[model samples]
Target: MSHLSNHDLPRLKKNLAGRQEHNSLKRYIERTREREYIAAKLSTHSPIEVDTSYRVAVRKTLINPRDGLSMKRIIGESDLLPVSYMQAGMKASKSVCRIEIRDSVGRVLGHGTGFLIAPCLLLTNHHILECEEAAQFSLAQFSYEVDLNLMPLQIKSFRFVPEHLFITDAKLDFTVVALENDSAEGTTLSEFGFLPLYPESGKALLGESISIIQHPSGAPKVVAVREKKIIDVYDDFINYTSGILPGASGSPVFNDEWVTIALHHTGVPDPDDSSKYIVNEGVRISSIMKYLNRLKPTLLEEQQVLLDSIFAGSELANYDRNPMVIGNLDMEWYERSAGYDAIFLGENYAVPLPTLRPDLRRDVAKLTNGKTVLDYTHFSIVMSKSRRLAYYTAVNIDGGHLVSVPRARKWYYDSRLNRKYQCGPELYNNNDIDRGHLVRRRDPVWGSLAKKANEDTFHFTNCSPQHKNFNQMIWLDLENYILSNTETYNLKVTVFTGPVFREDDVLYRGVKIPAEFWKIAIMVKRDGNLSVTAYLQTQKNLIRDLDFAFGSYKTYQVAVSNIEILTGLDFGDLRNYDPFRTITAVTGDIEPAIVNVINIPSDIRI
Candidate 1:
């Protein structure tokens, strides 16, 4: 159903046409038939953003091939599809369901369609399941269709578990939610196989035939297969012709292989006459997968495990992470990516790496080529030879161009450094210690080199041996908020990070576990001035017999000078730019406390 009345339909179209994203979408759709444009797009996102396997699959299909063949000629290629196409469709339909939206008293409000993207997770339109509260009050009813005898099958219904996982994006107009594992009718969610959502764009192309499994107007499930063709495929959205029924919102749009392509949202109305629809719009599944990767780090351990299951056997698995070793053995590390640009924020606002104190410089590890600084993708590391950890790491982040790199399980050792000083997997064996990243995996992941940077972060030179609890507890909350805030504000930032070492640190498994870590962020403010801020996270040190915040570490917004004094390093002129400079201090009181503890987003200072 339309959100706006008939009278306002023309005005809605006019306003939408003015949006930058909408304009870009139209331009991309218009140029889809151009061979040069298609080739350019493929080269830009292929292998990483657009997987190689998906490309080969799309090539074998009758869809819009990149060979410049006319749509008329390609239609004859449909015979290439498998003979079990009908059986594939039958298996896919089991995941579809009718989402019954209701009021506080359990009165039926309306209905929409949804599908299982995971064993116990459902995907639908945001307009249907708007918020966490809305999802909690709704029900997902499966097997509502009739049997072969023309009698209704016993319906199995499940309630939403929003507390476990509820992620929505208003711009994309999609919602991904968790459902109870078991339904009221004693049916396990595993009985219905899910449509795994992949993050590559080669699943479909412009002019490809698409299908939608919908429960129109609260009725039984129906399949509108290959009726409405995909007219356009662009950033995060797919545009199709207007053959779809009005009440089919929240349906899952699929390709010939029954693989999901989009989440059906709304129809585009003809501006001149509101009664007639022109094109239909849906949020791309690939875009949603990318969004999930960004939010994965913030999820609980259980939630992450569930999410990882979706991509278990696919190309994103652990073996595929070291792409060169498995997929392209001939390929070596590409060192062309400019690492840690000092003036990335502002041309004149240069923030270089911290200079080491005289005594600390003697312990700096040099590579085989005699360079003290090791460059990898967007970040650089300066390792401590004696401590076998980074003295400090620097990274340049382009928040605007940032892309989510699929997570990897293995942390590798840099070939440039010897195994003895690399602090590889030996320290973490049979222990709760984590290979804490100094240059965060996601920090340097942006632009075309996002995948490379992600792999580079796994190198041992970029991490420190830290406790598992400290790596994922209160400290994680504080860092996520601060970094997200900076990305929201400036869109570009340079960060410096490392652990605060002590002479008498706890020696666990032949390595000293630094109980505290520090980070400093620099960004160009909207007013064109440089803004720098420093943070400190303290954790329980067994050897020191220190504990705070019920043994959980506390993150604080400390002055840069204090960090300099503690780490025995020089931040150059960057120290004077601290916003919280004079408000806090390193005191001598018994059980000394940091005055500016940053527990939440609002507490962080720019």
Candidate 2:
């Protein structure tokens, strides 16, 4: 045989490259046809959302595990009708894409394939985005496929939403990151028909024929189907014979119905021949979901909504948070007609309201009147419209009715109140002020009414801006300690809280920052006598010298009567039951004792 001369080397290499490209294009076309066939068959029998036949097949596979079948057998036996399958493939193709991962300075570091699990979320391999650094500089290229004319490629690129969520798990080798809601081209990710993550596992089978839509070797998008089969299934991993190359790391593995089953990760190499591969492996979608469920409750409202879509069949579907409307829950009511007054048993079966609401400000501030009275399951509030803050929030907690629900920090603007008059996220964002819930989240959470009350506290009308240090430390401890030892109050306690809106309060960003806040906790004692203790916490140090950063706050147990005088809001008959009433001086003001970390619980006069 004659070896090629130097002159022929260039031609030979060019011919080989052209051949490889041709083979890739051929494989992509063939798989695209298969994907469409499956989708079309699916559309004929059921609505897209509820594919009963697909579910039944998955269920059957799980009930009786089977060995892998030959590619010929799998394809020859496919029952997908061509027309419907073509429609389905066309629908699903929009979701699968070739992703180019770039580093800082816009240089492409690597490439992979990712699919949308939610409108704003893309699921990929952890190895593709290992850390915040990787996420900070990466770009997600979607629709990187040949145009209808089959000459030029069509693609949309999106940067990661820097201020959004980027969660990764190396142990599971999966990363779920949020894409910018819209690309620079103004195309929303939702318009792409993003694939929803299958919450449950009855959707994929042991011997199912799977297809991988991927950007193999960082090349243009391709669908690898002909040789794919789920050879083995482990608890955390699945082995398949899908055709993939180096850059197919995060490609989605889907069943005939276009439902995602697993995330393609790595391929096994043939030990005898290093150049060839044996079987490819992927992280099980079910396993990825288990990890996602652990994070749902803790995510922000928008994030929870995204996660809820993935695991919609589970409890997350009814997630009541709406990002557009600040603090709006789907349930229709400020009061659920569930009668929260019933919990205020004994002498006062009714929640105490402020006798006199905060006087309208006579200052240079704009008066957009948001002062709206709203009622929740376990609490009520009289929000000060002019000040854009709550005048007072009254809450009745049946200490005996405790629900160990973790606090859901889902803040919102009360819909009943005008958004302009409400101090919203703008005031709290990038500032030292914490959006303090005047009606503590856990206060109203009891029995069946817990969820509503927990949700109620998120409204901006029921929230006030307090120093972060003050809200999280002694202030929070006081609430928690009181609830923990509820037996002291016969398992029932009522709290009245609000900011001390003095005219001279520090002004920050057009909103008056209250320097002080007060809380009065009332309960029926063992003797059936009403007992009330008042406490005041101040973040005066934050703005005293124009040093408006968060600093330590002082807590003092004062007379309830003093709180009434200082805030100009009456605390009802609770003033007469104050434990510190006798401690008042000749000036009619009870001197406050310094409450420190050492005696936060004991220092309280209660």
For candidate 1, the per-residue lDDT at 409 reads 43
Model 1 lDDT, residue 473, Cα: 32
The parts of candidate 2 lying over 4 Å away from their true place are 1-331, 335-343, 348-351, 357-372, 406-410, 483-490, 545-547, 585-598
Give one digit per residue, the lDDT tens place, for model 2 in 1-606: 234343443354344334433433333344556545545653443322233465444343322111223222333454343354456566777877666656556666567678877546788877676555666667888777776677645578888763567778876777888777678888766567566565555555544566778888777777765357665555677666645676678888877656677888766655467566666778888789888867765766445444544442222111221222344554356535332352475654444566663244332123234333566777776666568787777777765444534335466655555577688768866555666667766668777878767777778777777654453445555654554334445556777888888888988888898888888777766676776777887888877644576566677877776787777667666767776666543442345352222234545656
The global C-alpha lDDT for each of the candidates, from Candidate 1 onward, is 0.68, 0.62
In model 2, the worst 10-residue window by lDDT is 313-322
Identify the leading candidate in terms of TM-score. 1
The C-alpha RMSD in Å for every predicted model, in order, reads: 14.4, 19.7
TM-score for candidate 2, please give it. Answer: 0.44
Q: TM-scores of the models, in the given order?
A: 0.52, 0.44
Off by over 4 Å in 1: 1-127, 130-173, 176-287, 290-337, 408-410, 471-490, 541-550, 584-594
Q: What alpha-carbon RMSD in Å does predicted model 2 have with respect to the real structure?
A: 19.7
Most lDDT-accurate candidate: 1
**Against the correct fold, how does model 1 do in TM-score?**
0.52
